[model samples]
Target: MPQISAFDVVGPIMVGPSSSHTAGAVRLGLAARRILGEPVTHADIGLHGSFAATHWGHRTDVAILAGLLGMSMDDSRIPQAKELADAAGLQYAFQTVDLGDVHPNSVRMRVLGKENSIEVVGASVGGGRICIYEIDRFEVEIDGSYTVLLARYKDQPGVVADITRILASYGINIAFMKVSRKTRGSDALLVAETDDPIVDDVLELVRQLQGGIVARRLPRF
Candidate 1:
């Protein structure tokens, strides 16, 4: 038998009628927002499978908007997310689309900021948990259970080692790390989940690395 945690038994503290649809949807949106690393000015959301079929009735749309606005799952404003988005100048639209061979509770979000943009694909697995599986065409596995450091760079020798060295120097323990590349010595995406939060100074150090394009920290959700 599989072990069960407190969260699995009691669910999450949230404004919700269902953990999978509402709470998980909120977290998915939040993950997208954090990965973008800037205020979301516009968002184009594509719902899939069960999410596409039942999102409106379950208020998954509202939950996603609340998260994009940086609201926690239990925020009282979740019910008014649409109005809030309009007031905050957040342009958004939602449509159903086939994401292909993924979880039923999946969604693809293309979020834009003033100077940056990101595309994220994620799914709400149950008990209010989520998994972010893709970011900007790079396959990843982020579960929002650890402080994550995302680095995008031109793939080259010693890049990963230097980043690990920096984290080690800061005494931050890495729980998991994955690097995905389009081709050898080409563009690469590194996903590092650390036991401790990555401070701003450390992030800046990583940002200054040769060939580093972007480095962002995503706090555990």
Candidate 2:
């Protein structure tokens, strides 16, 4: 059994009039930025249900975009986020998407950068808690705690082993993993949540594999 603390019941520390709509949204954005594999160039953001309709009122739009640009909550630029993105040389857009059967406080983002593009979905789960539902096509649920490794590679044998070996070489342990593919022998992203921060050399090893893998590391703070 787990001990329930007063703080856990009272909730998380955050800047907010609304934790689920604001703070959690920011965390979600940062998480997405991490797995995108490179600095963001173009961004197309979509909000669903209640998020689509009322996000602006809650400043969810600002929070979400700020996350992708790697801006902390205290960053002054959050008030004029679109301008900030442009001034900082980041491309960004915001629109609404109907998210069915999922949480209402949700945002999905498509971010483009120098060498890669990615789509990430996350929901603010009240009290500043957020959950990452997917990245591109991989299905996952992230609690915003651990560093993540996102890799795309040819769907063949030994891929998982190769990744595990490389992580083992560096003493990195995978706490969880999710693999996805649209079809057999097609490409896939190996989404891994690790026990500790990831170093760049591990990514280099993954890129060296014959099947070809685009790798990235995301740290959750």
What is the TM-score of each predicted model, taking all chains together?
A: 0.96, 0.90
On TM-score, the leading prediction is 1
RMSD of each: 1.2, 2.0
**What lDDT score is found at residue 193 in candidate 2?**
90
lDDT of 2 by residue, 110-212 (tens): 9888888888888888777788887775777877688888888889888988998999999998999988887889977788899977888998989898776
Which residue runs does candidate 1 get wrong by more than 4 Å? Answer: none
lDDT values, one for every candidate: 0.92, 0.80
Kindly give the stretch of ten consecutive residues in candidate 1 with the minimal lDDT sum.
Answer: 4-13
Instruction: Name the regions of candidate 2 deviating beyond 4 angstroms.
Output: 5-11, 74-77
Error of 2 at 104 (Å): 1.1
- Predicted structure 1: lDDT: 0.92
